[model samples]
Every structure is written in structure tokens, then in C-alpha cells.
Target: MDTERLFDRSYERVLSHEVDGRAFFEGFYDAFLAASDEVAEKFHDTDMDRQQAMLMKSFYHLLSFYASNNADYYLDRVAISHNRHHINIRPALYDLWLDTLILTVRRFDPECCDETELAWRLVMTPGIVYMKFHYNRDSIVGS
Candidate 1:
């Protein structure tokens, strides 16, 4: 699946009226909550602390900043903050996150699985790397 096709499909899915932002968020939130538990169990750690939950919420907000008026500034600020504050970004957690996202998208639009999977892989691969790099850099610098 090429990028253009994938994006087109994503756009189509977005405009289909079958998939709403609220539904996406609700699905994502539920998936994240479930993944958090799996993460804790897999790592022998506890559920995410309040601080972690707050941080995750902020990340979601940052992702949505593109829909706002000051999108560029908001995006830049989000990137900077991710670079400065998210030090302990875990790959396993991210895998779980992506899984959740995929599941959510599939739940909403089963027909778009192939396109969604391709789009998500395209978007998330670079995103995860960028996030992890900044997060690790932040940890080292902050410490």
C-alpha cells in the first residue's frame, strides 16, 4: 500500500461518518487502559501511576493539537516537551499502544483493516523512533 493510497483511505475512513472522533477516542482509551494492565503484568510492574496517566493524556492532547488553530506551535511544543520530559518511553508499551490503536480502528471500520494497518505502520514506525530517541535523550540530559 503506497502512502498516497493509504492516506486517501484514511481520509475516506475519517469522512465516512461511520467513524467519529469520539468513538475513536473512546476505543483508544479503553484499549490503552487494557494495555496498561497487560504492560504491568508483562513487566512485573504496577499499573501506570497518576503521573504516567497524565503524561499519556497530554500526549493524546498533543496529537490532537493539529486540529486546533495554532497547530504548528502546538506541535512544536509537543515535540519539545516529548524530548524534555518523556524519558522512560518503553518500546513494549509502544507496541501495546499500536496494538490498541489497530484494534480500535478495526473495531470502528473492519473494512479498512488493510489500509489502516498500512497507514498505522507507516505513521507509527517513525513516530515511535522519534519519540524514543527524544525520550532517551531527555532522560540522559535531565538526569
Candidate 2:
């Protein structure tokens, strides 16, 4: 099975009205924030409306990056902004982020299974790794 196609199928189900629009993201952030105090503190000043919108766009970039293995303009922007010079997201936080996302997927997607969840992780991990790789390398790359 194609990971991207399968992942997209499951993700679309979670996003559709049947599951409630924005509900998945809301749950993801709620769980993600609650998973760690650092995560909560990082988002304490954030405008979630905007953050969710960004995340909505980001998922596509993640899928795209995974499918193409190329950090396109949008993905590059995401990496640069989150690099050490900017938001400075810790590498350790990504594990919590992915776990929270998969947990939310299980909660929101009625059809979710081990394969479905693995698809999500497989599709999202490259982008997560990209973000983490750029964290300290921002200096050499000129973020």
C-alpha cells in the first residue's frame, strides 16, 4: 500500500464534516499541549486560530516533502522559522508532537488502524526530521 495515499485517505476522513471540521486539530493541540509543560509554555502566547491554520497548511507540506523528498519553498520557510534563530522548538518535542497527532488520529478517525497510524507517522516523520535537522544547522544554511 502507498503510505501517502493511504495516509491522505485517513487524514481526509478525520478532516471531513463527519468527524467535525477543526475538531481533529483542536484535539491535537489540546493533547499536545497537555503532554508536556514545555509544550504548553511554548504555545501559551500563541493565537491558536492562526496556529491551527498554519498546521493545516503544514500537514500538506509534510505530505509533499515526504512524497517528493524535497524541501520546497513552504517547507523551507517552516523549517527556517522554527530554527534556533526563531521559535527554537526543541528536537525532543517532536516525539511528543507526533505521538499526540497519532493519538488524535485514533480518536478522530473511526477507521484508524495500526497501518493507518503508521502511514501518518511515515508520511509526517520526514518533515519532522527536516524541522529538527534545521534547528541547529540554521547558522550554516543562513536562516
Candidate 3:
């Protein structure tokens, strides 16, 4: 998948104004909301909207950690925090995120959709669990 290269391209696209990173993030956020809505419906919970918003904030914090490009501390922290939060860590949420990313990439550069998907798949390797909050206490928590 050449994740490094793909990340480079993604950054380039963002920096060069070829694609609006903010807009892409918004789409990703919307996907999270939709996934959370589905999960809430399945569980017959009415707090899905609030849970989804909290997850979005947590994801933003993770993104900031990644942007720092420091030690792998953020990875471990994210992993542990995700395990603790348990609302943002669903396979269905990941599927929704991937779909949103694919659509965003296709909208900006149709030719890069395949590569973007490949890179995304590599970044989200098997055995990696997404974060979700089971307790309301962890809803506002972020890494």
C-alpha cells in the first residue's frame, strides 16, 4: 500500500489546496455521526448524538497527536484510551469512515481513489480496534 507515500500525497493534496482537508474531516465527522446513530438505534439508546460528537472530538485529538509526529506515545495512548472509551470503536464506524474517505478522495481526485483506499486499509490493519465509549464518563475523554 505504500502508506508513507500515500500519506505524503494526502498531505500534499491538503497543502496544495487540491482538496479541502477541513471538508474531508467534516465528511468523516458525518460518517461517525451516522455510524453512531445506527449503533444507538440498534441498542435503543437515545444518547447517540452526544456520543457521536464526543467521538468526533476524540478523533480530532488523535489527529493532532499524529500531526505532532513525535514519539509513538500517542499511538499507545490512543489505543489505551480507545479500549477504555469503547463508543468510537466499532467495525461499522470504521466502514463508514472508509466510505467517507473514499468518497472524499474520489471527489477531489478520481485517479487517486484506489491508492487512497489501499493506504487507508493499510493504516487500519487487522486486529486494530476502533474506540467507542460504553460509559458516559468516557464520552468527553480524548487522547
Error of 2 at 75 (Å): 1.4
Candidate with maximal TM-score: 2
Give the higher-TM-score candidate: 1 or 3: 1
Error of 3 at 108 (Å): 3.6
RMSD of every prediction: 7.0, 2.1, 7.2
lDDT of 1 by residue, 17-90 (tens): 34455545555655677777654444354344544555556545444442242334433444456553543445
Per residue, candidate 3 scores C-alpha lDDT tens digits across 1-143 of: 67757855764563344445454444444444565666445446446556556645554555544445332444455555544355335545555655665565555543466677676555443223333332224433343
Error of 2 at 22 (Å): 6.3
Report backbone clashes per prediction: 0, 0, 11
Q: Over the stretch 1-143, how does candidate 2's per-residue lDDT look in tens digits? A: 77777798898888862344458888789889989999899999899989999999998888888888888888888787888789988888888899999999998888899999989999899999988888887442544
- Per-residue lDDT, model 2, residue 102, is 95
For model 1, which pairs clash? none
Overall lDDT per candidate, in order of appearance:
0.54, 0.85, 0.50
TM-score of each: 0.56, 0.90, 0.48
Model 3: what TM-score?
0.48
lDDT of 2 at 122: 91
